[model samples]
Target: MPGKHVRFSRNTHFQSPPTPALSFSSISPASSYAPLTPPVIPNNYLPGPSPYTIGYAPIPKAPTIRVHPVLEYSSHQNVDFDILNHPSSITKNRRLLSSLVLSEPATSTPLRSMVITCPHLPWIITVYPQSGSHITVYDVFYEIYRSLHKSITSSDFASLPSDSARRASTRAYEQRYSRHRSSRHRDEEKRSGMLRIDFLMGMTRFAGLSPTGRGPDVWQLNIR
Candidate 1:
């Protein structure tokens, strides 16, 4: 058996298999893959001021503070000599007297008005001020005691209406005077004199004297 011969044309060519177009149903879901994100950068990477920001912020101001003036003794420019001298005037103006005494400087001199002759006694008690010398509660007290003692010991004090009244007055005066002689006394005697002065001035109890505590000599007057 003879086979038939097959011949191909010069223009005849063989082609590769055509690629198929991808369909939506055939594609995988985007959730299956990880999401894309920007890279992380450190704070020190920029090494300069931010472009969005301006100059440095203003500094806050400090709060204002008010300081009060300290209370101190004043010079006796407005003191009335007549009122300061008279016992009756002192009795009438106990509060005013207290204020005046409290404001007096410790180194202040005894005014001439402080000198007085005892009405009930024959003695004249005087406080003489010396240059550059300071006075203390003790000195004032001593003068007051002398004046009070002279009065209490006089015939006039003994001639009070009732004997009981006279005895009470004597006992009171002695009790006050005896405190100075006590061993435990500090400035107690002076305090007693202050009380006596207040009583004589007709005040039930006036403000008391206080030590400045800065020194043994420094004293402050307290007014209530």
Candidate 2:
């Protein structure tokens, strides 16, 4: 390319854009900005009192045990209680026996079974009334008392239910046989001490008026 004119400087220095100067103003005395310090939680410092109110739920208490009522029932028929006087007089059929005092009323129809057990006797007298008759008839069952040699105090005996009467009877039995006490007998008594009566159907059968089994004609009373 012809006729091109070019101009050059003798200073020989690289040209660059000039940077603008920066200015800083003095911090205001009234300004809130200050050096960072740890957060100041009132009432809280090293080994100092805490601000939070800590608490816990209360613990639950155990349930109280239930005590059963005393047995107070009356026998209407004047049957001879002595086994010697009447051998076959234990069962009372059509006996109009009614409970004088009951914790709960007879919820269903009247159905009662009487069991007469004595501490001194070796036999249990059970009177089952014939349906619709309620007269006295007797049956003697072999009394198989668990040989437990533990005597309960009169105080304890009075508070306990008739179901616990067996325990008392067993204790009485143990006392009578205490004269011939031996190590073997003591061990056996200790083992049998834990045994208790399974059921106590007072004045009435616990399972009153219900179909008992696979028989159509058979029925039972679910009385507790």
Among all candidates shown, the one with the greatest lDDT: 1
What's the lDDT for candidate 2?
0.29
lDDT tens string, model 2, 164-191? Answer: 6644544433443343368776554443
**Local distance difference test values of all predictions, in order:** 0.32, 0.29
Clashes of each: 0, 30
**In candidate 1, which residue pairs get closer than 3 Å at backbone N, Cα or C atoms, i.e. clash?**
none
Candidate with top TM-score is 1
Task: Tell how far residue 45 is off in model 1, in angstroms.
Answer: 99
**Candidate 2 wrong stretches, greater than 4 Å:** 1-114, 117-177, 194-224
lDDT, residue 1, model 1: 9
Residue 86, candidate 2: alpha-carbon lDDT: 21
